[model samples]
Target: MTRSGTDRRLSDDEMASWLPLIRLVQLLPQALDRTLREEGGINHAHYAILVTLAQDAEAPPTLGEIARIAGLSRSRLSHALDALARRGWVERTSCSTDKRTGSAVLTEAGRDMVRRAAPAHVAQIRALVLERLSDDERETLTHLLGKLLPGIESAV
Candidate 1:
């Protein structure tokens, strides 16, 4: 391909590695959302919030913390919190010590939702990804992705 001097295009070998990663990044979320919505009436992001809250059941994390962990902006997290609250799956409350600080608590129904939805989600992940890879392939992919994550996180 022709390029101007300033254009530093990827080499063929780089494209070979990047193309599949790009496609997987683009497609996997849509596929997960479809299955999650079909199975539980919530998209993957909402499910992720539920799972994260479950992980910190003893002390609910603040909205900012949840947003950071979930890679969502504060505004996006607020919107999601509103929806989850409406569905009776979550309750958002201001911290007693600092009224300006807000945290999310998963309801009993939220736990129930996670319980009912986890099986289907796990199955879809397995079918679409894990089952397709050998043990060694899975390990290598995990290592490579882990190496990439710091840069990705920093960019965000």
Candidate 2:
């Protein structure tokens, strides 16, 4: 059987589960951005870029790879990299095998900055997010969200 029109709306149970999650999805990034800007002098975008690069600092990944990991478009990542480069925190080099391709390498300064920011950033996350849930709830949340990621990624 097929339902139509008003019958298509979310059920009460579904709404109860979704509303808070929707709000958190909308607002958490802003809160984290505010904290990061105040404490680290960087916004979440820059922080994400730096963190991704630092993960493979010895062999920097290509811009496309970084873009995919950071969930940013190439143009947006390029702009952020430009700003970081001006701050002397990251350097971009043309790929040795393909001059048209580029990769971002974290500078010593960038590595140090991420290291300095990590502890406080993690603390902020704990205070705002993790501390709100019990250990079992946290585990369940991770498991539930992980189940959704593949579908979400494919939809995009």
Candidate 3:
């Protein structure tokens, strides 16, 4: 009853469902990135890093924790931090108690930038995604994606 790899292929029904999801996955990031760049001179990844830091602004978390929360690899996080640091929007610092551990601190400028950029980002998201779906459809989509998240997370 097992199908060989060579024999495996998506059925028309499966392709019908998958094609839009594939397109959405690829196009959504580009769309969001365009908005982010225009509104704040930052891309989605940089915005994610800033927002992650801002979440714990009062007591910045370690780089490792930030990496996990921001869904970025450590090296990518380091590179993003370098850009943010150079822009004076973030500062990388050692933990006072743990010399070997480091944290990304969101600067006042970063906070201000998020404040200014968030509204536009939200509006764009609404325009591109949320408003397009009915409430029930949105809820169903959220539920379906949540089911897929575990497998996707594990792959990463």
Which numbered prediction scores highest in TM-score against the true structure? Answer: 1
TM-score of each: 0.88, 0.85, 0.86
5-84 in candidate 1: lDDT tens per residue? 67588778778989998999989999999999999999988898898898845567888888887668899999998999
Candidate 2 residue lDDT tens string, 1-156:
343557868777778878988999889888989988888799888898899988844466899888877777899999999999999999999888899999988899998989988888999899998999999999998999899988976776
**Most lDDT-accurate candidate:** 1
Residue-level lDDT of model 3, residues 124-145, one tens digit each, is 9999999999999999989998
Clashes of each: 0, 0, 0
Estimate every model's Cα lDDT from 0 to 1.
0.90, 0.87, 0.89
Model 3 residue 142 distance off true place after TM-score fit, in angstroms: 1.8
List candidate 3 stretches off by more than 4 Å: 1-7, 56-59, 96-98
Question: What value does the lDDT take at residue 8 in candidate 1?
Answer: 82
Worst 10 residues of 1 by lDDT: 1-10
